[model samples]
Target: MFETSLSGLLTGRVALVTGAAGALGESICRALARAGAEVVGVDLVEGGACDFVADVATAEGNRLMVAEALRRHGRLDVLVLNAGVQFVAPIPEFPEEQWDRLMGVMVKGPFLAMKAAWAELTGRPASRVLITSSVSGMVAEPFKAAYVSAKHAVNGLTKVAALEGAPHGLTVNAVAPGWMSTPMVERQLPEQMALRGLTREQVLELLLDRQPVKRLIGTDEVAALFAFLASDLSSAVTGVCLPADLGTLAS
Candidate 1:
């Protein structure tokens, strides 16, 4: 495990990460834990390594997450709005239910998560909120209307919340990742292959061709950014969407 010299940067703090069952989310939880934060991982399913179970798409579920965290850890210092699902389909043919599902989990979930916990975040000194956004938040792509729009909404939420939290010493920011090395991206590959009528290799190349870095960004790399945003080093940083993208937006 690669450790930063600034290990334990989040000592004496507590963090809550949603979507903690997924690959990227797990990486983020582990990163924050290693940085000395009492990481509380939340997810809906009963399995896959999260500390709590709560559906982020519902108001009640989000409220329970805060309650559970406080019940165990006493106070919240960092909140990572990371729970989400990926949808792939052409716009004209996209299902309304799928759109609602994506928006519910991606956009509304963050809003509810923040709403339920903002007071707790602002209650502590040097608290922070990090939203896991995507390059789609900044740019568009075929068959990604729902996911893109939801991410865009999150970026806006991050900015507005940053302004509101500034006077209270709470920092809010987002990280817009490019192609991530996660199961969600893996699952979408076959869909992309069929959608674009290309082979697996072709689909891979198509997805990566625009990224100047020429490779999928790993969950660990993205988690590192989350760790940084969660730590004291990022006390002055807020309301900005940092692209851990491989220059995807630059091109």
Candidate 2:
């Protein structure tokens, strides 16, 4: 267990994290909760310690999320638009359904969540919005066209929201993770390895080789970056997509 160092980082803030049931999402929730922020975790599947259930991609879901946030904490101070999906398929054979799913969760989800929470975020003090993007947004990856495109859109949304939030004292930014050890990657690893006719170990080796550190980035590491962005310490940082890719983006 990581001891909390976020004593007063977000002392009395309230946070809403979409896709909060996932490994990465849960980590971010834990980080914010430890920082003294009241966190409401939202996921389509729900469960866990999540305070609410909202789809985020649909108008109704978005509205429910905002309503739940207000009902739970009275005011929304942090918005973590982190709901997304990864579809592994080549461009030519990519499923249109997968593309729509990815876009809905990655791009549209954030837009809706931000839109629904706009008044609350802007009306609060020291409000922050953080999006969980990916290295794919900054670099190319094999068999993930939809995920890449959606991530790229996430950065665009981040920039636009940052600019809009600037005058209102709200900061918006993104943390782009590399190959992290999470269920999402593990599920795709076997299939991706089979596609390349390589063993699972070899596939991991291929991923690690791209990183100068030669290791997989941890979910907690990505969570730490989110923690930083959500804190007042990063008050001057916004409209930027910081890659936590273990140097993968450089190569």
Q: What local distance difference test score does each model get?
A: 0.91, 0.87
lDDT of 2 by residue, 63-147 (tens): 9988988987699989998887887977899999999999998998899888998998998878999999988888778898899
Model 2 residue 47 lDDT? 60
Lowest-scoring 10 consecutive residues by lDDT in candidate 2?
Answer: 1-10
Error of 1 at 236 (Å): 1.1
lDDT of 1 by residue, 1-251 (tens): 53664488989999999999998899989888889889899998755549799999999999999999999979999999999897899989999999999999999999999999988988888999999999999888999989999999999999999999999999999999899888899999999999989999999999998899899988988998999999888877999999988888888
TM-score list, all predictions: 0.97, 0.96
What residue pairs are clashing in model 2? none
Cα shift from native, residue 167, model 2 (Å): 1.0
Best candidate per lDDT, number?
A: 1
